[model samples]
Target: MNITAIKDKYERPILSLRITVTNRCNENCLYCHHDGMITSEDEMNADEIYRICKIAKNIGVQKIRLSGGEPLLRKDIVEIVNKIASLNFKDISITSNGTLLEKYAKDLKDAGLNRVNISLDTLNPETYKKITTKNLANSAKRGVLKAIEVGLYPVKINMVLMKGINENEVKDMFEFCKKNRIILQLIELMNSENCDDEKFSKEYHYNLDSISEKLLNICDDVKTRDFMQNRKKYFIDGGEIEIVKPIDNSDFCANCTRLRITPDGKIKPCLLRNDNLVELISYIRKNESDEKLKEIFIKGINKREPYTI
Candidate 1:
């Protein structure tokens, strides 16, 4: 079936879907955005998720990523992975806190998960506890190693750089990724609609411009991912670092090709705004026809616009 890909009014094609499987998390990170979800209750089941993905697949979406407050919090995560894998997405990955990766990494890989992105903001146990209010830094480190051992290739570490918090640990984090042959993604702290704590954002939002400039000078090679908001990937000696500075970045919003699904099963058009969500679970629960669901998908896509622009 030659399905034509759908594009928003801005002419950006919807190529990837980021589904928040569960809003429940084990860590209380000081900078957590809760996956841009306003509410966390009443998460969709594996079957509903599969139906949503199927509709997405039929609409020419090729990639799928499972995310959450911490995706591993869900007990049926492996089952969810299996169902999504059955749709034959070009890629099946998850963004997790990594505390439970050691226990679920192999099972996830076996269930057709292609890769993983684990959040490890700091290597210092004390600092980790300070940021996350959890004493699981060592456990997360073990999970990182286990993910690599399980052949989850290109296991990426998502390090959200905060001004007075873990910003100074970027070099150390890069070294750690180099030692393990993993990719490091340095994400600038962002303020979302629900997490718009003015004082918190002002205190912790670190500008990534200087770090990006430093990487540009020392990087052996550089690559730009056009589909991913034109983010740059810097290749160092044996390590890889990707700089994600979405705050006030027009190009980032212009080139985005992602559609987010909230944990409660609403089609979230933009990560920064929640007002334009198109409900899906209610229709799915009503056993709506595929045509009806596709209309809902198109309605959501039509709502998509560059949040920064």
Candidate 2:
């Protein structure tokens, strides 16, 4: 396999592949972005998904993160993970709502999942229900604990900061993560078509810029993963905090090394815009050669542009 890194027009290396396995989710979070995927019943089967990942690995994509409205909604999730694991990518992770994780954490770990990022916006069960219309906060917590017990190292909790909502839980969440020995990621809400509406995003989107001072005060040693999504990490009293800025920021696009694949097997070059996706499902259905698929991947990489610009 003569693998070479695929660089976009802006010269950014494509090293990460974020695949939305399915749009079917168990919880309906008001702020869910659906990973910029168009929700439909046209999801790729496990074999189709594995083939894509195999082709991806052949072309220098190092990290693969399985995401969805909720990836666990797919019953064959473990088989999907095992197939991807066979590729031996540098890192293979999943972003899940964690409701069903308690039952599948061990299976996922055994299937070669490196880490997990579970969405836990508010620790309060009532508030969680209000935000997601699901009262599974206790289940999510147990899933996190189970993931840790099963050796899913560095279990990360993703909390979306929303104004007049869960914003006040920063300190409490930090404390909770510190006690639990897990990583806490504070994500700034993004305005995507998958969101409830423009009104809801505008009303709830809280800028992390306002709380930078408070974050710095809590942690002195700040580390920035500049080339890898511009994520900032801070460590305080053995607890780690990562701040994920909004994608609308040009800096986020400028440093992005990732590309996305929607559940239906379309190549989404940019998350903020839906105009440039290269279709792959039809070609795969036609039993296209791996080389032909590789060309499509290259074409998709070429189509990538900074959406914020």
Candidate 3:
């Protein structure tokens, strides 16, 4: 496997691509960043996304994660997954709210998705309804279990800890993941300019540093990822727990290894700062050659900088 490496100014190779499939979502989660976007209607079709992924693979990107307000909201999501699967990336995954997974889990697995990360804040149905403004917690739970049964190895659960919200459910979530063989990731609430609830983010910003100690104490073994903003992984019982604390952390920025593509087809370099994005929707729509498109990918890589440092 001969892979071309794209390095940033800090020598961090761009190995993962988080593509925002669409801005449209089924639920209205209060803490949603919408992929650092305020509002958008522009969404790339399956063909456009395939071309982008091909260009990305040619430049040494090995991992691809499909994200959205809800990625499965796209009717042609199966086709999109099939197209990207043809690229032969080492890993392919999707992050969703999990409301629709039960319907599409088997199809997605057959289409070459390697894993899945479902966003679930709390186990309490009332709290879930309050946070997401939707009573789909039971539906989401069924989706997670179905994803596991359908062979989506390491069915990860992403839980964003909020002070007055789901912070108290950390231990409970860990136990749930262990019983169900899910990977529980504790994420810190992100404060992005794109977020509409600035006061809510400020009031509920609970750092993961304070909770990591408790996790470490309960875990049996520790594992680590060379990539990812949250690199620490603790093995507990039959499940795994990872901590993601990316807000205002120089260490996180220094270890970061990702490039983002918005639903509108712009190559975003950093999630925290939107100024350095390289517009590519026009070029993509113009049907530019792969060589030309590769230039834009490199340009996006060159624009990468340590947002915290």
Which of the numbered candidates is closest to the native, going by highest TM-score? 1
For 274-298, candidate 2 gives per-residue lDDT tens digits of 8888999899999999999999999
lDDT tens readout by residue for model 3, 1-309: 869678988899899999999989889988787878646798999999999999999999999999998999999999999999999999999999999999999999999999999999998999999999999999999999999999998799999999988889988988889998898988888877767566865698888887888878887998777766647899877778888886476668887889999898999998877788899888989999999999999999999888762
Model 2, residue 4: distance off in Å is: 3.3
Which pairs clash in model 3?
none
Off by over 4 Å in 2: none
Q: After superposition, how far is residue 254 of candidate 2 from its true place, in Å?
A: 0.3
TM-score rank order: 1, 2, 3
Count of backbone clashes for each model? 0, 0, 0
| Model 3 TM-score (2 dp) | 0.96
Question: Against the hidden reference, what TM-scores do the models get?
Answer: 0.97, 0.96, 0.96
TM-score-superior candidate, 1 or 3: 1
TM-score of predicted structure 2: 0.96
In the range 8-99, model 1's lDDT, one tens digit per residue, is 99999999999998888898888777877876789999999999999999999999999988889888999999999998888999998899
Q: Model 1 misses residue 118 by how many Å?
A: 0.6
Can you give the lDDT of residue 271 in candidate 3? Answer: 82
| Residue 15 lDDT in candidate 1 | 92
Candidate 1 runs further than 4 Å off: none
